[model samples]
Target: MGQAGATFPQSLWDPSFLFLTSGTSEGGSREGLWGHVDQLNRTLAQHTEDIAHLRDDLLDCRAQLAEQLEKNLLFPQISTSLLSVALMYMEAQRKPDPEKAIAGGTGD
Candidate 1:
């Protein structure tokens, strides 16, 4: 029974062979459905491969960035050391008192 007490036919409720054949034919050849499925599978495989490659590339970039950061952090110390050596060389050229400069340089 449907809405408002309307009696529905028993055949409408039954699973008949005619209903199955008509439904399949209306959607065209089954081969087309199989082709679509194959295309979907190929696309999924390509995307999976792309994702794997991206993961590897991302990991490589992260390692390179870490190495770069380590080098960058060491740069300031290197620069300061170089500057100190240069200053010492300049002071030596000026013949400034070594003891005074080592302790505290005279205000000139």
Candidate 2:
């Protein structure tokens, strides 16, 4: 019931929830209570470390998302510029050179 496998009630680990169970006190001793408090302290310390690791992971994800969003915003403008260049090239190819066209034409 305590610390994932211990035989004591889980409530003893948290002083706020602690109640003196009949099993814990035949003559009212405090040693057992102190041991439970120590275990609980260790458990809480480990949890703080875990939370810090999770915070680092979340921050990394946020940075990656911002980079992707910037690329997404820029893609449309790049595509539009490329398309304009391609259309201009095609129009140029369709037109004959001014000198060639004039020479080939009769004096009209």
Candidate 3:
């Protein structure tokens, strides 16, 4: 009598330990438990891989967006400076009499 057979009585009164000794005789129940464990481990590994890939993609998107924002922001400042210079040049050219223009007089 092995330890498994000795620990469990031949009666069905001990349902817990009875399954351990009385089964398909081919260890089918034990194999089922191991199969479940393997499936759970595979699921965990797949989820971990998916999360890592998503994190890397998010970081890459952030870097690209930041670069685009920097370029967009810098473009407006350059455009504003160019417009200001053009306006200043136009105002300087329109002023026929500089002294009168500064004094706010029509030169009458």
Candidate 4:
């Protein structure tokens, strides 16, 4: 085989493609293959864990947003109800003026 690729510095893409081929064994040892496999497994496990955490965070954020949206949607109605209740309470607490009641008496 020609050493055209080996003559220069190894590019960034070489290692990923090289290790999969039969002729490019890492020092002609099976240990290298197992090492790569183990690394890949660890990476996969870490990614799975990260994805789970992200999903949980997303769900929590969604719940919070839903709650805030509910509050926002009902704010006007709640305020109006409270104002009406306050007005009703004020109206109930007001007493009739004594002078007006006496002056408006029937003259028959």
Candidate 2: 10-residue stretch with minimal lDDT: 15-24
lDDT of 2 by residue, 1-102 (tens): 336665444454654335443335542446666677789999999999999999999999999999999999889889999999998888776756677777
Question: Which pairs clash (backbone N, Cα, C closer than 3 Å) in model 4?
Answer: none
Among residues 3 or more apart in sequence or in different chains, the pairs in candidate 3 whose N, CA or C atoms overlap within 3 Å are none
Off by over 4 Å in 4: 1-27, 84-108
Predicted candidate 4 versus true structure: per-residue lDDT over 1-108, tens digit per residue: 366655332553666444443445543445666788799999999999999999999999999999999999899899999999998898778776777778994322
Using TM-score, give the best candidate's number.
Answer: 3
Per-model TM values vs. the true structure: 0.51, 0.54, 0.58, 0.53
Candidate 1 wrong stretches, greater than 4 Å: 1-23, 78-108
Q: Count the backbone clashes (under 3 Å) in each candidate.
A: 0, 0, 0, 0
In model 4, the Cα lDDT at residue 27 comes to 37
Give the clashing residue pairs of candidate 2, or none.
Answer: none
Per-residue lDDT, model 3, residue 38, is: 95
lDDT of 3 by residue, 1-108 (tens): 556556544565766544653456643476675677699999999999999999999999999999999999999999999999998898776747878867998643
lDDT of 1: 0.76
Q: All candidates' lDDT scores?
A: 0.76, 0.73, 0.78, 0.75
The Cα RMSD of model 4 versus the native structure comes to: 7.9
